[model samples]
Target: MPACEITIEKIDFEEPIHIVRITGALDAYSFPDFEIKVRDIFEKSGRNIILDFGKLDYISSAGLGALMGFAKIARQNNGDLIILKPTPKIGSIIDVLGLSKFIKVFWDEKTALNSFVSKAG
Candidate 1:
């Protein structure tokens, strides 16, 4: 089995942001659970989200699609989904796939969270 774990932590910024940290391989086998958890968070909290990719080592096409899907949902609900500190490998994949065009990517967590506030203000 591929090693993957998804954990969400709420960050208490002036405007709260949910940080979903994914670790290990996010491939076909693990993406479903990841998708579900993110959807649930958006449904329950309706807060903006920052996907922390600092610890994420790998991401398959399915994983990328799941993220795009969730970002779409977040946008429709007046929330945003930002990507934070993707590993170089994953960052390249995201760039090649044009995911960054849809979701902004930040090298720093504080910058990513602050982006949401700047947009609203």
Candidate 2:
């Protein structure tokens, strides 16, 4: 089995949104690490954030909880947290949980980023 690992890749976008691309399995074992990175991002800069999950392999309930937590924090800061390129598995979970009503999921980074820009402007 592959060891659970989560990596945050920074993206350079023209808008004021901060894109954090997360790649790897986001399981219970990796939730803490994931939370730390997400918390830091929200704490340091309250920017409209897009979480690109194109390369993410897996995610558990704990991982979803982390995302929800970040979403709540982002909302409190008057920012939004969106997901980009989530695998079908992850997308389905979000859909089932009714989170799709709160967060929008996009197929690509550009669309996700554009939505943020549109909302901000």
Q: Go through the candidates in order and give each one's C-alpha lDDT.
A: 0.86, 0.76
Best-performing candidate as measured by TM-score: 1
lDDT of 1: 0.86
lDDT of 2: 0.76
Worst 10 residues of 2 by lDDT: 1-10
Summed backbone clashes in each candidate are: 0, 0
Clashing pairs in 2: none
RMSD of 1: 1.5
Q: Tens-digit lDDT track for model 2 on 1-121?
A: 3455555555555545677766677776777777787787777785578888888888887678667778888888888899998889888888999888877799987787778667767
Report per-prediction Cα RMSD to one decimal.
1.5, 2.0
